[model samples]
Target: MRKALRLTALAGLFMASFAQAATPIDVYRDPNCGCCKSWIKYLEANGFSVNDHVEPNMSALKQRLGVAPRLPPCHTAVIGGKFVEGHVPVAQIRELEKHPELRGIAVPGMPAGSPGMEMGQAAQAYQVIGLTQDGTDEVLASYPASSTQ
Candidate 1:
């Protein structure tokens, strides 16, 4: 019984360390964008280690990253070699990391109530779009507007 308990404790420790081993994300955003900062804070609060890069030329960076032109762009993030554009939520970001078939994901425009774009009692419906390996846009998830008046 003691040996079994010791092995269980060891397994728990290993699991804890693995959980903390998430890849650090590099976020590039305009220096003057407040929403980007808020998004970074949200990520940090959700247990992500964020490396914030205050970019000077956002359009050029977005272009270089191959962000879809149809997808409304804002701050850009790279995690595990996948581009995360706009205000993607933490859940979708995790899903993106797990899907090797997707090139990237985006929340498109800064819809209200998404992560950092929160507006008190006002939320706009939005879709989380995934850029597939073939460069096609796929709706990965959709969020409804807040019902709170």
Candidate 2:
């Protein structure tokens, strides 16, 4: 009985530490949007701990977070002290984690095949934009015609 109890306690400690090791991502989105929920699920599935915030004024939230007014998406997230706007891919998210110098990353506008915006055969080519806190922007990654996700 004592051996079983020790093993159970050890397992609990391992689970707790594993959870703590996950990066925490805070997502803000409109309450009425279904795509936002899908995006949150995508993040969670990719090993991110998500904190969802149902926001009524999305534009205001974007403005305060340093996301350009021109770049708009169904949802926005704050991860690793940087802003992530739109349906950014898991690979790109991992890239940002590896390089914390970037101020933010974004996929402006909703394109089908993206994590939340996906539908059947309607995906469009899009670029993942990297932005500095100063408002300067560049294409960090691009999804071609064949793969929009």
Candidate 3:
């Protein structure tokens, strides 16, 4: 009975730790951007602990982070030292962890119906672009438009 009780306690502890686990991400956004705040709330809901930073000059910040001037940058985020630009979904963000060869991943522009940019089920088709270590862009994931729209 004591051995069984010990096993159960250990299992419970493991599950507890797993449940409390959260990925830490630092988000930099312009103070005037309302959508960025919505994105932060979405991240928190998806088990990410956000370290929010309001930057006055987002252009300089994005440039310093290696984000290309061509990409539509609403906000910039760092996850495990990799840049995540624009409104990237949580699933693709998790996939980024598996590919160390990628310098970072981005959604480019704010697409309607993305996590924070939801517009009553009107989701626009978008692709998650990944910047490789070799400095080439690749499509990592594609989100289709919602049929309900």
Tens-digit lDDT track for model 3 on 4-117? 999999999997886679788999999999889999999999888899999999989877878777675698999887889998999998888899999788997889988789
Worst window of 10 by summed lDDT in candidate 3: 64-73
TM-score of each prediction: 0.83, 0.82, 0.84
Compute the lDDT for candidate 2. 0.85
lDDT of each: 0.88, 0.85, 0.87
Judge candidate 1 against the unseen true structure and give its global Cα lDDT, from 0 to 1: 0.88
**Model 3 whole-model lDDT (C-alpha atoms):** 0.87
lDDT of 1 at 126: 96
Reference-based lDDT, residue 94, model 2: 79
Off by over 4 Å in 1: 1-22
Q: At residue 139, what lDDT does model 3 achieve? A: 93
TM-score of 3: 0.84
Off by over 4 Å in 3: 1-20, 147-149
RMSD of each: 4.3, 3.0, 3.7
Candidate 2 structure quality by residue, lDDT tens digits, 1-149: 99999999999999899898877889999999998999998888878899999999999888888888777777899888888999899888878876555688999988887877777775788889888756788788989756424
* Candidate 1 worst ten-residue window by lDDT: 15-24
